[model samples]
Target chain A: SQQGEEDPQALSIQEGENATMNCSYKTSINNLQWYRQNSGRGLVHLILIRSNEREKHSGRLRVTLDTSKKSSSLLITASRAADTASYFCAFFSGGYNKLIFGAGTRLAVHP
Target chain B: GAGVSQSPRYKVAKRGQDVALRCDPISGHVSLFWYQQALGQGPEFLTYFQNEAQLDKSGLPSDRFFAERPEGSVSTLKIQRTQQEDSAVYLCASSLAPGGFDSPLHFGNGTRLTVT
Candidate 1:
């Protein structure tokens, strides 16, 4: 079974706008990571935030984690058409070396 | 430097037939992984390998699924007696050894397997 579930299965925004996607997981985890997939290709790693860290930032991307709530969110600022893709949140359970993913949020950025 | 790469970007297999998918990880990468992704779902873990050792394969759906990395650089995933339910995109990823909170995985384009 999948450990996490993402909110707002799909999102659409214009260029330069911001987009946010939420994810909720069911179990204790060591860390959470976000990835992006373009078209029908492979996923590209976006960012990872450890359980000890509440938030992280990478350029136009920002991620927040709340273990108490077992939830996480990904924010993209100044979005571009290039950022149009499906975003997924993968959870790494405590001591399990394997990462489980949520259903994912599909984002569309209109130019 | 080359990122991870997979062979036969697309494949069509008849039900009950066997199919092999290959992955070539980035040079010197030590941790390799395979995943299955349905049309609208996130990729699910299928297996993990550390060098030539198969450390974890708990995610494999059934005994018909097998994977191996003979020399630590290239890996292969084989499915015996494929079923219609087996149709999906198969992705391969690799990371540096002793992966931690920051070891970002590099992924391949994936093989789109269509089982009829």
Candidate 2:
């Protein structure tokens, strides 16, 4: 079964604006990772934040995890047209080795 | 010298036929993972390999699905008696570290399989 659920199934924004997507999970998680997919291609790992960590950033991607609420959010600052893709939040259940994914949030950045 | 790669970017098979898909992880990567993504759905875990040992297969849908990473570098997922429900994008990924929340997985472009 899928462990997480992302809100606002789809979002569209201008190239220079920021895009924010939220994910909520049902179980305790060891870590949550975000991935991006362009068109029909495979996923690209964007960032991962452990349960103990509240937030992490890499380049324009910022991830935040709130264990208490069992939720996480991904923020892409100053989005670009290249950033137009489907974003997913994959959760690794605490104590399990497998990663379960949410339905995903599709973001479209227009130039 | 490169990232994870999967063979036969796309494949088509008839129901009840058998098929094999291959994956080559990044050099020196210690962890390998397999995932299945249906249309409009997130990728679902199929199996995982830590080195040459498969640590997880609980996510595999049924007995028809089988995966092996003999040398820990190259992995193959073989499906026997394929069914229409098996159609999806199969993805392969690898990470530098083993068994931890810190290791990040690198993914391949995936093979789009269609069982008709």
Candidate 3:
């Protein structure tokens, strides 16, 4: 399967703490993306990193990609209870035009 | 502007019944995708449409699953002879350009189907 694998299936943290999740893929990819989904809601796009880029940052969120290792990581700084959701990593491979998603990491931030 | 819209937030059907789900993508968006998400798992790719044309459907589980985007705006996914395994959330997403690139997808809340 071209599906990536996310590390730490679940994570629990307190508000104001940092949370990190990692994803590993099996094939070379064009780009990687992160998404967040609240319970019973659709996924919201968070960030996208190309295979040539090493890292990218958005407000309160940082993503790093290592093509040599075929892995990527997402870090949320000063997380809030509202940040609690499932985080998924999806990637597009060379031949496929669709993004393949991995089983997500469920995050819980307690207030 | 409104985001992607899906009709029939929830549906319950008996085994062997047929069901159709609807998706209204963001206006002017050219790419549409369908995914099936089982509980506690990641969303699985089902099909993709660029405008009114279906470019890739390799992820569709079986011939029983059918999808179409008649006018390059609204799309439908129809399932025949539903089974328990078909119980899942059907998600629809659209992008400004063709997918698998830098364009991020805009998604709908999705329709949950339950087969008994």
Candidate 4:
């Protein structure tokens, strides 16, 4: 079963605007990681936020994690046409080797 | 570095037929994983391997699905009887380190399997 659930099943925005996506999960997690997938392509690791860490950044991608609420968010600044893709949040269940992924949020950046 | 590699980019099988998908992970990588992605959905965990050992396979949907990594490098996922519900993209990933919750996975493009 999917442990994480991303809000806003789909998002459409201007090329230069910022896009924010939210995710909520059940149970405690060792870490929450975000991934990006283009149409018909495999997943690309974005950023990982450990349970103890509140926030992290990679390039223009910022991720925030709130363990108390079992929620997380991903912010893409200055989105470009290239940023159009489906984004997913995966949870690392403590002691498990596999990651439980959410359905994902599809983002479309129109130029 | 060359990332994880998967073979038979596309496959078509009739219902009840057997099919095999192959994965060639990065050389010397200790962890290999398999995932299934349905249309419009994220990749779901199928199984995990640590070298030659079949460590975790709790994500496998049923007994008809089998996976093996005999030599600690190349892995194969086999489906005993193809079903329409089994049609999805099978993704292969590899991590350099063990399943220590630290290393990130590198994914391959995946093989699209269609069951008719």
Pairs that collide, model 2: none
- Candidate 3 clashes between residue pairs 3 or more apart in a chain or in different chains: none
lDDT per residue for candidate 2 within B58-95, as digits (tens), equals 88999999999988789999999999999999999898
lDDT of 4 by residue, B1-116 (tens): 48888989999999999999999998889999999999998888999999989889988999999999999999999999989999999999988888736677889999999999
Between prediction 2 and prediction 3, the one with superior TM-score is 3
Task: Tell how far residue B68 is off in model 1, in angstroms.
Answer: 0.8
Q: Rate the local accuracy (lDDT) of all candidates.
A: 0.91, 0.90, 0.92, 0.91
Per residue, candidate 1 scores C-alpha lDDT tens digits across B45-81 of 8888888889889889999999999998899999999
Residue-level lDDT tens digits of model 1 in A6-59: 998999999999999999998887788999999889999999999999999999
Over B1-116, each residue of candidate 3 has an lDDT whose tens digit, in order, gives: 49999988999999999999999999999999999999989998889999999999988988999999999999999999999999999999999977647889888999999999
Model 1's TM-score against the true structure: 0.96
- Name the TM-score of candidate 3: 0.97
Tell me the spans in candidate 1 whose CA falls farther than 4 Å from its real position. Answer: B99-101
| Candidate 4 CAPRI assessment class | medium
What TM-score would chain B of candidate 1 score versus the native chain B?
0.96
Off by over 4 Å in 4: none
Task: Give the runs in model 2 whose Cα sits over 4 Å from its true position.
Answer: A94-96
How would the candidate models be sorted by DockQ, starting from the highest?
Answer: 2, 4, 3, 1
| lDDT of candidate 3 over A1-111, digit per residue (tens) | 437899999999999999999999998888899999999999999999988999999999999999999999999999999999999999875455688899999999999
Docking band of candidate 3 = medium
Query: Comparing 2 and 3 by DockQ, which wins?
Result: 2
What would the per-residue lDDT of candidate 2 be over residues A1-111, giving only the tens digit for each residue?
A: 687899879999999999999999998777888989998788888888888899999999889999999999999999999999999998777445687789899999999
